[model samples]
Target chain A: MDKSIPSLAQAVADIPDGASVMIGGFGGSGAPIELIHALIDAGPRNLTVINNNAGNGHVGLAALIAAGQVAKLICSFPRSADPRVFNAKYLAGEIDLELVPQGTLAERIRAGGAGTPAFYTPTSFGTDLARGKPVAEFEGRSYVQERWLKADFALIKAEAGDVMGNLTYRMAARNFNPIMAMAARTTIAQVSRIAPLGSLDPETVVTPGIFVNRVVLAENPAQEEVLNRQEAVYP
Target chain B: MTNPAMIDLEAVKLTNAQMAWRAAQDIEDGAYVNLGIGLPELVAKFQPDGREAIFHTENGVLGFGPAPAKGAEDWDLINAGKKAVTLKPGAAFFHHADSFAMVRGGHLNVAILGAYEVAENGDLANWSTGAGGVPAVGGAMDLVHGARRVAVITDHVTKSGAPKLLTRCTLPLTGVGCVTRIYSSLAVIDIAQGRFVLREKVAGLSVEQLQSLTGAKLHIEAPVTDLTAAQVA
Candidate 1:
């Protein structure tokens, strides 16, 4: 457990281009704005990123996607409304996209943390999502063995962190940070406040310090909400 | 004899179990609910079936629904124990890290549960007590603690003829003072002042008969009759 905290940009600038990254947030909430902004400033192009949903229009993960640094986006839903720009320019042929069912995406990341090579889940069994995936039957039911999903770096957002790196996520912003921390080789967190170790309730800490490699502090921005629209524009 | 106990039992169409589900219909829309396995799953079958309230699974679901089609049952799309499922519009998938967040964070409005034993003090021990061994305490720990309101549905008596709603739960605790309201075959009870506040009584059973079968005192609410089946929404 490192006791030092650095600026968000300094922590993320070391990550090279083409790295496997996982950002934590659901919809447009709880995104690590400081690290994302830092990554954009550093301009490490051609990277692969994973998250539950794409950032919503420059507020969440939307910042990185907007900066043209993301080479390929592997996600279930990209509701940020900027995928059109990504598709026309960066993803036209240069970048790639792998769209997956939400269940499969979570299981893959969970498998990474559980140390399971692969486990069969009935989630995408009969759908085209099972194409080329390992198949098996258990207890009179069939499932696909979705492979483990891990990354080189998992950038997470937390409401607060202690010197020991124990974390507490605030509300819906709590999305994928804890599991992503376990699945990544190096986990960095941006927290609004840094407290002494043992300050937070053990019952409330979502992601523990053991999985975290670095702690960065920045005044995280307020959460942005996605307004409901009649027609979704994504292809 | 004076009032002439309704000899006509013909209008009742619900099975013994469906009667229980009709009792569950009182759960308002937009409520956060947890449906236990078995007869309780049927509650979903009866809920005003549209996008009204959120259905949560201890295995990790916040916005997941649209029950599976008969043929396209994907075992993976299932709930906590891996049961097949369907997805509804406006449903979004999350890494359970966030789903449980909603639960533990007190974001849930209600949780409908199935129980084996509900104590007078609202203690519950529904997970285990099978013939083979102690039950596997899976996600029950999380769901019990996380859910804001826990309403249980179960039989009034155990298979061996002992009261299921006892003066105090005999099995290990799930959550301390966790339950809010209880719906059983013989009656519906709300925990009031560390005791069972009987809200409704079965048609055939009297207050004394219901009380003698229990380990706790019963507070009876007036006009106790069985619930009626609602048109499926």
Candidate 2:
């Protein structure tokens, strides 16, 4: 109804260098590939990408990585799928990295949305995890709660959306999109399909419209890039 | 149905006090385990010595150790509830994406969790009771489907004197038939023949009472007797 946030390129064109962002997905399952491509084309430099996985060599977020736009990466690097072939440019002293454990990564984002600055946890104690962190105890045991994390923008992928930005994800695709929607100051959604307002069942919307700041309808259904091979080849 | 073999009836029953030791025995050396929030969280204290299984905290630390001391708290290394925890040697830190991958990737061997309701068919619904006040399932979805073994630890009955075990759970489901074993205050039940087969029970409770409390048919194992920690372990 409100003229769909202009355009994808226009939306991301203003993002400054060194901007912090949270890109939602589980191993490239739910990333906003179209918007990511737009950023790649628009050529924003020194961008810090926070995502589950760097998309495989050719598509998804890898477009930016390949285009040499991402200057730093703050995410849970894929132990299973690395963007080595695509990311070699950055890994060779071209970019910065801050790797967070998967669980702690989610909590930091969630805690940021919950309005908490920081909390303690017991995940990292004696090993290299505690090497640089401050430590303490509870009930004779130790704990370390990480600080909350927030981003200037959060780019997410959803299965369907409405004019109000009420969104839903298909099956496992829901992954981290819903949470990333809440953890950023400006959350943008790239969806496969768009529906009229009130067309979607209220109960089924996983992400409420309030959290979404912009929405883009991806046109390249044929080239809907993702990390997993099955997703790339399907349809 | 009952097993009429000659045996000590006491050995079939499990008391509340023996739960920790019995649960500890389930842990083998070098198994990667996740201790769920609530009662299941207590399992960390009961782990057997000389066994060095890695513990993962959903908050992001793998190779998790015991809780920490006062004035030495690290705000960034906490559990799902923002609680503090200790890290074991060689423990690694990463974002939740990788932590869940480890879980969903079949890297974790066992997950000890608390349950609100368990069905005869192994349907687990521990997330949202849709109650007036309580936290809903936040990470239970990933935990249940990812772990190799899902062990439920809880009391047999509700505080209102009702049973948490039901004929079919009316609460939101966590997974269908995902539960491998159930450890309760009065009994430990295992999945048998598509329903619960009583592995052991607590002292002084009757079979009829157990059945009534379960609200479902349960097959009592042979050689009925009270359960010691050894039997459950």
Candidate 3:
């Protein structure tokens, strides 16, 4: 019953070159920076990374992209605050991008986790984005068929976790983390703090322990401090 | 949204806030609105009194207030754009799926968005130009297609002076035939029956001048009237 926390290196050591990974976050808010930094330092190449934005500034996934670690990026927003690295790589044909609409991205990840292979959504219907995709009409409206988005591993960030891996997220930081956790074969969460099993309330747990395989505490406490101050106002 | 006061309204013809203010007048009272990033976000701040429009951000915050005051930013609280914002009373955070359901399920009454181009036929192309670039399409596709009414706010022309209201969008579209109205720096245009009709224009601008600047034909059904300063204020 013991799924002990591992060192950041051991946590991501299983990730190999060309593995499809889902990294969670809207920007840097809920990003698991320490684990991502470790992954970058571990130096896996040609990886396909899925996330919301490319990355903000020169940190997190951006650092991984800047290191030339990623071969493809499947994201909703590829352009962020400073997207020069991705822009340059994309324009030069050094990397590839598969842009999905945000809502569809979330639902696809959710669908992937829920064992649904595909679903019809009205989003992006009748547009170039819907081009060449399977289309269906229900009640006189068009819908594009989007397949489930699954990955070999999901790297996520959470506010807190119990020893059993029950997790909770802070405010908007919960963005893509929970969905990615469900959508991946192996889910590793980087959390601010770990509590005892009985200390976490069952009703409040956002991601039940079954979905998360490993939990690692953030290397930098200051990052957690910033999030703490941000969430301080809310319960 | 950036401060509208900083913009040279005369040079750009209309400030972003003024454009938002113009759009706000059309939004009815007690409407559930979703404001997209950039200029559309300013619409919430300018929402007139007596109209209690509940704002929704796709990242799962609803009843969100305007941007937090400088130095008072809370990292935990952010809109879908990843910018820090204050939460209004009764504001609630839910799962991303539910937030999007409110959008895709057509629970939202109106969605105000920024656009790259809008064709005369009401096709919206705000996500990307599709010219060799990253082409990040966020929730624009769902918001335009799902919202009951879609309103676009944008510059009349690009920085390079290319008209954005076109005969047909040469760019990748976010949604087809989704735009109901357009509030631009130069004029308030409505898309009806596949034509861009002039509703009102900023002072010192004429329908002929608008036609010269617009790539598509401008249909003037109503008497062209000056957009008074008080109306924008």
Candidate 4:
């Protein structure tokens, strides 16, 4: 129902401090840089951020971490090539880190989005990472039980969207954004362009409007170009 | 005095590209392969001619091509390493759940990865050092368990010259009894019944010399072939 938000500032205004936020990005490919900047300017402290890597360079989530807004980071890879921001903060004990296997992290969020409470997985079944977690055995194989991971808000970036908030993302940029959108209480998508309703092919829609609460047009359509220019970052 | 049995240590180590080329020969046609980051990624570029294997990346692109040439990078098209990639003619992009489901569901025929250590029993430890430092475990855990075959392409030794083929992995394990074969700079080894079987070695490198550098005991297969010199170039 016309869930368009005109400015990034207005979009992130209601996100309170200490919110559990899921950010969408895979090495800056699908990162919502403008929305992240808005979140930084909005100054919400003590945030719990969930993403793939810590951040790439200084543009996306790294800026938020650098600004000291993030209190805890739940991610798969907490170290990047230039992990200066996350590294410095983590070394200083300024932030808490939770490193989940990339697949399990995605599954947990998917479970949350689908309303599944918990699932047992073979991923991390025998490692120290599985320590303290409940283990279940099936067919003589062990699996670690992981609970669903939901967020207070999910800020995502999409290649295209409609006024109704249906989204279509680019190649790898589609990684965590769609799942995070479904798992969050409120999902705000930053898009390069918004088309008229029904203009986008229904089959091409990766995230339907029902999951998206609002859509904010990104300030830079070429924001993702930064991803290619980035040197091979550590995982 | 140098032992007559020990080959010149500095003369015959394979390059990462050569290891990748060797690894590519193991991939069967009509297989679904996942090329892990680093050395394994190079396999995509040197895939065996006349072999057709569909490549999958955990970040949701399948039918991926080799790394894009310089200045041809497309940010939207990237592998797990965050390096720009190209999409093959039949490439498809899906969501994270589906991408990993392809991984965890045993749809992938092979997953070739770089490793910190691979135990003789087929255990792999590549995710972390087990130190108190920040742990970074990506999709290796999922890939190893789900892929039908797991191959590792890594340097033979650590920067300090410690062998990576170990009796037991001292670091946190990514998967136990998961790796099927190992393609290293020095040799191509297979794990069979908890032993490292040497199948191929670099020219001039003797079994005794290789064993001295290896942390695990080795069983040499008959007629160990020397890697062709042209493949190294």
Output the better candidate (2/4) by DockQ: 4
Residue A47 local lDDT, model 3 = 97
TM-score of each: 0.53, 0.52, 0.89, 0.94
By DockQ thresholds, what CAPRI class is model 4? medium
Could you give the candidate ranking by lDDT, starting with the highest? 4, 3, 2, 1
| Model 2 C-alpha lDDT per residue in residues A65-182, reported as the tens digit of each score | 7677787776654322435533575446676666564555676787787788987654434323335777787777556658888889888877788878898875344556777788
CA shift of A191, model 2, Å: 1.2
CAPRI classification of candidate 3: medium
Which model is ahead, 3 or 4, in terms of TM-score?
4
| Winner of 2 and 4 under TM-score | 4
Query: Lowest-lDDT window of 10 residues in candidate 2 chain A?
Result: A226-235
Residue A209 of model 3, lDDT score: 91
Kindly list the per-residue Cα lDDT of model 4 for residues A94-174, writing each as its tens digit. Answer: 999998988899999999999999999888878877889999899998889999999999999998999899999988889
What is the full ranking by DockQ, best candidate first?
4, 3, 1, 2
* Residue A232 shift from truth in candidate 1, angstroms: 21
What TM-score does candidate 1 reach? 0.53
Model with the higher lDDT, candidate 3 or 4: 4
lDDT of 1 by residue, A1-235 (tens): 5744577767887789899999876554555756776778878888899976655544445667767778877776553434444445433465566765554566578678778777665544433445798778777656567788889999888878987789887544565677888898888888888877778999878788888888887764544332212222211
lDDT for each residue of candidate 3 in B170-198, tens digit (9 for 90 to 100): 88888888998999998989999999988
Per-residue lDDT, model 2, residue A51, is 72
Q: Candidate 3: which stretches are off by over 4 Å? A: A219-235, B1-12, B159-162, B220-226, B229-233
| Number of the predicted model whose lDDT against the real structure is largest | 4
Off by more than 4 A, model 1: A1-3, A80-83, A87-91, A226-235, B1-54, B57-233
